[model samples]
Structure formats: C-alpha cells, structure tokens
Target: MEEKAKSFEELKPMLRPTGVEPGIMKVDPEKCTSCGLCIQNCPFKCLEMDEDEHPKMKSGCVCISCSNCIVACPVDALSIERVYTVKGGFFDTETPAVKMPMPPKDADGTPAEWNEVERVVLERRSVRHYKKKPVPEPLLTRVLEAGRFAPSGGNHQPWKFTVVTDPEFIAELEATLHGFWSGVYPVFNNDETVMNMVGVVETGVFDPRTQYGIRCIALKELPVYLGAPVIVYMGAHTKLNNPALTIGICGQNMNIVANSLGLGACWTNFGAVPLNAMPELKQRLGFGEEWTVVTALVLGYPKFKQFGMVARHYRPVTWFRPGTKTPQTEK
Candidate 1:
C-alpha cells in the first residue's frame, strides 16, 4: 500500500475550519496552481500573493477557519495548521489564525452574561421515545417564538420555518425519508450501525416483536415529534455566509425555551439534505428555492425526568490554564 503524501494544496481546502481559529496552514507544493485563487476567496483576506503570484500567508492571524478560501480555491492549495501543538486538536480542520467574535451583549447593550442560560445548556439532552399525545398549539408557538429571536448576521433574518403539526404530514415526511434511506443502505454498509440496519431492511421479513429503529429515534417512538406533539423545520437563505450557524443558534434558542417550558426537544439534520432535493416537499413546506434547510427539531413533553448532572469530562482544562498541569483549587 502506498503511503499517501500530503497533497497540502489539494487537501488544504478540506482543512479550513467552519469556525474557531488562529490555527495553521499546510500547503502542498506539487498540487499548488499558484493561480492565487485561495487569496482571492479568503473571507478574512489573510492570504496574499507572493512574488511568484501564489497564495501565501498575509497577516497569518486574521483567519477564522471559515474555510471559504479553501473551498473557493480552484485547485486545493491550502490547509490550516496550528502554530501550537495543543490548539490543533480541537479543530476538525486547520483554521487560519484568527479570533472568534465575542458573544453578543444583552438588551441593555452590556456584554451578554447568561448564567442561567449556561446552566440550561448543561442540562440539555437528546430525548427520544415520547408517550403518544398531541403537542398543544400554544407551546409550539412559544418554541418557534424563541427561535425567531435568535440573532443573525447583519440581522438578515433570512429564515423560514415550517412547523409540522398534522400527523398525516409528519407520517408522509417520515415515510419518504424512510424509503430514501432504505435505498441508500448499500453504499453506507461500512458503518457498523448502518450495516446492521441494512441487513434488517433487506430481509423484508416482518416481525412485529422486532423493534426496527427509525431514521431518528425521536421520530420513531414519540407521538408528537417525540411527545411534545410538534416538530419545527428551520430553513435559511444559503446565500448568507453562515446559514448553518444562524439556524443552529435559532435551534438552540428553541431548545432552551422548550426546556424552560418543561418540554423536551431533539435536533436532527437527517431530513434537511433530502428534503431540499424534493421540490414538492420544499414548496409544501413553504421554503423558497434560495432557502436551504438548516435544521429541524422534534419537540414534546418528557415522559420521565432526565438523569441528574454528572461530572463533565472534556478535552482538558489545562489548555485554558496558564501552564500545563497547573494544579487546580476550586475557586
């Protein structure tokens, strides 16, 4: 087997981080076109043309890992690398050296502080398998209201929402998704969970006692989008630089609001891609052609209380500390 050499130019595009930064750039000499395309498309203007008219680091620290330049490059020629060994591990791809913007401030324009909100974030969990009951219209409205309040870039507010309340619509949507996924099982057989599902689906032998999991656990077991009786579909204008981010913020807002209201919510993206491909479904959902589905949520009341808080294990607190292995005393 040939060991793959780093085609930094070709592979660099994939390394650009969607967010988070002040990272590294790895370039491949062999695949570099020197067309300066990377420099042209960079959102932060962090890339520049060298004497050879090839893309090179400009300020180096202006990158935010948006990956725009990497994706825009005609020939993949850039990869983000971390200057420090410790910072590289957090990013899925190399991010250009740049700082993430600070979170927004509160209504009084003071830098936002949300101790309660932070607490809610820690408490949130994915809840599936809800008891059969219709979600009330008022509660669904509140969840959507919270989502609409989410901030957007330049306050574009370019989002549309479709709340699937009718059981028939939900059933139809789920059935369509089920068929599509069932067809694609062969291609994804390498995935163990998917492979097992493929085996079951292929058998075509119906066994009522055998529990066949649906696309999303929330979609399968719950009566109303997992028991809250509502599902919210969030769509965004893809022309924006960060549609996904915008939609995600909105989704979180809805989730938090739902939690506060004593409702449970689970986020899912399984429907977005395929749902967009079907024009009829998109139109029925009232989303426009310029709009792309960002995310969806299954919402309902919890059948049982969440398991209480446990120790939060994460990458490491040492990275944020002054030095490695600094002994901690709870402040």
Candidate 2:
C-alpha cells in the first residue's frame, strides 16, 4: 500500500538540520495597528490573533517563509527575520534527477560550457507549425518533469498540469471553444446597449482586440491550438501569491525543455479564458473548484527547422549603484 502523506505537525519532528536560515515573522507592537491583515492573508494559517488582538503564531505553527504576510500588512509592522535555522533537507542532491546531458568538462572539473544552454534559450521559438507526428510519452513526461521543478512563491508549488493527447478529445475541445467564440462574436459589432449588456454579463469589460481574435478563431481564420499533438493545461490555486506568474515560470521551463529535446512548444492563452468560463468543461478536464487555468502549452515536432537567434528590440534599462551620482541608463 502507498504511504499516506504526513501532515506538517507529523513531519516536524523528523525534519533534519539544514544550514539555510529560516524566515520567522516578526511584528513590531509599537507599529502594529491590529488590523489583522497578516492573519487574514496568511496562506498557511500559521498566524492567529492573540488575546490582545495582535497577530501571533498559532501553537506549533509552521511558516514556509513566503513573506506573504509581510506584503499583506498595510502598516509595515510585519517583517521576516531570517534568524531561525532551517531544519530538514530542501533537496536530495545537488544535481537534478532528470536533466539534459551535460557537456564534457575539463580535467580540473570546471563548469561545463554554457554555449548549448544559451543556444537552447535563444533559439527557442514559439512554433506555430508542427509535424503530424505525436510526441512520445517518455518525452512528454520529461517536459512535465521540467515544469514540476519550477520555483514557486514560498514553495507552495500550487499548480496542476493536465495533459491531453487524445486527438478526438482535442478536436472536441477545439470545437467547443470555437462554438463559444462564434456565438459571442456578433456582440462585438452589436449596438452600444447590447455590447454594454454583454460586457456586464460576461467580463465587465470587453476588449475589441480580444473580440477580433475570437472572431478569427470562430471563423477558422486562425488555428485554434496550432494543431499540436500534445496539449498541457496548467492550473494553479487562485489564492496563491503571483499564481499566474508562477505558472508562467513553469510553462517556460517546459518550453525550454521541449526545445532541448528536439520538440517545438508554444505557450498559448487560447484555452485559458474559455476553459475557466465553462464549469462543466473544467470539471471534465480534472481542474478542481479552487484551481484556475493559468495557461496552456502545445507541444509537437516542428514542421520546419528554425536556425539561429532572432533579433529582438532592445528596451531601456536603469541601473543604480552606491558610487554613481545618478542612475545609469542603458538602451
């Protein structure tokens, strides 16, 4: 039989010593207004109001050191002190269990050259065209594993990945989304009153750009999901800090891994908005009530080879240094 997952309390005693400092929530009584925002916003429920209405850690409470409570405090009364020593091993080994093969190093054991790594990152393109071949199950698993190791705030790792490889199901999903968009496309061109009514009923505000995209998909002008053989849907808890950004990080990891594995991947928001809107579809696709679809990635072999890095427009950057008279600007 599979072992049952241990609760935090049960695992506390078994925790081993690690040298990393642990963040402990510290509250300044003089600065505190007793607003209880820290307690209310604590994701782990480690904080509770004391008898004096001041926020305090509950008995045997464990903090993940996410510092969410610190951000939630409006009065700047809360801060995280890294005084406590961390207990337990955060990682099993220095190297990842699943990683791409490393390049040969010198006899002195210097770090491997980063040329391959840089090429993977720079040459990866959002492939819109894909070959008809389906991605192998083992390769897909590696892609998912890459995503699983992505960093999240407080190590919450509050994300779920659902993979869809069935051609029939993917076709069904495409049809459903296309139908929904087709039904809603006419409202964009409707008179002001009807459009306003739609905005109120649907998303409170409707962008014409979004409507145009929807129309394109509805009319089959643009491919719904780029005809990729594998689709992975990422969902995260709505209550987590920067959940969408966390999912984006995870998706990028998958994208990079896919590219390294000689596969093409594209991050698409095509399904996210519609998937979340359809409760029945969401349930059918295995997303829980607390979870919201953050993004979707389609993966397959590229139809055509893309070589070299694509040129990107440069943006202005500001740098601050102690000795500098003013901030340095770079373009």
Best by TM-score: 2
Give the worst 10-residue stretch by lDDT in candidate 1: 204-213
* Candidate 1 lDDT, 1-331, residue by residue in tens: 9866554343332222223334345667678888665554443355766676667766534444445455455556666664322233223333223332235588888887656766577556665545467778888888889989999889987678988877777777777766665565333333333333433343221111111222122233312233335678889887876788888888888999888887777775555556777888888898878889777898776655441222221232233466756665432
Instruction: Please write out the lDDT profile of model 2 over residues 1-331, one tens digit for every residue.
Output: 9877555444323222233332368888888899876775553456888788788876544454545566556677876654223333432123211223345576798876657777798667666667889889999999999999999989989789899999999989888877877776676555433434432444312332344456666777556677889889999988888898898899999999999999988776866667888988998888978889888999899765532343332344588979878989863
Q: Which TM-score value belongs to model 2? A: 0.61
Best by lDDT: 2
